[model samples]
Target: MTTDRLTSILNGIGKEISNRQLASILTTGLESFVAEDQAILRTGLAPAPYISASHAHRDGITTQIGGERFSVFRTGRSKSRLNFLSLLRAGHEDYIVNDAALDYMRQRKVAPDVIARLAGHPETSFCSQMAWYDHLVRLRQDVFDPSLVREVSEAAIWGAVRDHGLMGNTVVVSDDAGQFRIPNHALCWVHAERLLQKLMPKTPEQTRKLEAIRDEICASTAI
Candidate 1:
């Protein structure tokens, strides 16, 4: 099927569909349609430049090209639910070794065997591996904050926009507890609704109250 036809069919739907199920509908040589659908679902997070109104989900894809590794993080879509703001290469790499990180592990008196297991490699000695693990742990500690992820991600996206010379505002919709601190950030309705759906009232009064609230919401939405 053509990309336009597939998009039209998918855009018409108001329900959720899984990637595996969507993939199954394809025969062969129609792979681009699936990618386009995913791009739409991701709100234009593809490598090519495109402005998105809003509609983003916090998701990532990993790939290696020309022997270089890349970690791509897609900003959640905006309220308009049109397209993604952009795709940013959140690079992956090993941590740098330093004295502080090593001192930390030494102070904790990490077991020798455990330390050896973490550090040992086919091409390196146990001591070398220990240093590598310590460096990695230190890097992890530096970025342990959830807010840090959001801050860096939003900055990278805006930076991309500036570099590409694009104009327009983009909103981001992500989980309530996600690490996305964009100016246009908003919690995903689907996730919020799912939480509400999970509510199980124990008492009769609670059940009635929950049902009344649900009914009101449904009525308001004309569902």
Candidate 2:
């Protein structure tokens, strides 16, 4: 039997195929490419990244990677939902383009025009933003912001994912800020539930609403 015909019959509308029934059909799908080796799932995060069977990470992949022995299998979920998580090394490590690390160039006896190029121009908003960003990078190392780190990590990850053969059938269904930028993109509704799950609803109405939303998400994402 052809893989496509088998998939067509399994996924046909009004066609309910049980897992055991599909034993003859290979259980593998596009997601298997990554899940087979790198699908280390830890949940309790915003629904955007959550698949169904997820475990929450008390510590985080970041802390685990700190030790001399960084094992991908042992790396767990992050306590903070905003945290950047990945199985790869060198995440936004450079934090910016051009490994050129220059600091406080104004103190030197360089010419005014030379400084003009390095320093941001007031008119150019992009230039100013970069200057501000560079200044922040020069700050202390403990300044780890998950959102910002994810922003950088996403760019690197996107490049690698595209360059490698992870496209076509492989669709990254995530509601995270940047997953849609990938080649094959899709969004998951369950992430909305994650946000509600984290909230401490005050009123009874809010509690009821939260429960309703979660129920809907569970139905959508669950098998």
The most accurate candidate by TM-score is: 1
Q: Identify the runs in model 2 with alpha carbons over 4 angstroms from their true place.
A: 1-55, 58-74, 77-85, 88-149, 173-223
The C-alpha lDDT values of all candidates are: 0.39, 0.39
Tens-digit lDDT string for candidate 1 (1-223): 6545565577679535555556666555776765664444333332322221222343432211110111233433342111122332122111221222223233445444433432442322113324544543553433355343323233333443433332224344456433333334554455556767899899999989988877665674452
> What is the alpha-carbon lDDT of model 1 when measured against the actual structure?
0.39
Alpha-carbon deviation at 110 in model 2, angstroms: 31
- Flag regions of model 1 displaced more than 4 Å: 1-189, 220-223
Candidate 1: worst-modelled 10 consecutive residues by lDDT: 62-71
RMSD of 1: 16.1
Q: Write the per-residue lDDT of candidate 2 for residues 79-157, one digit (tens) a residue.
A: 2322332322122222222111112122223334533443343321112234535543553212277444344333333
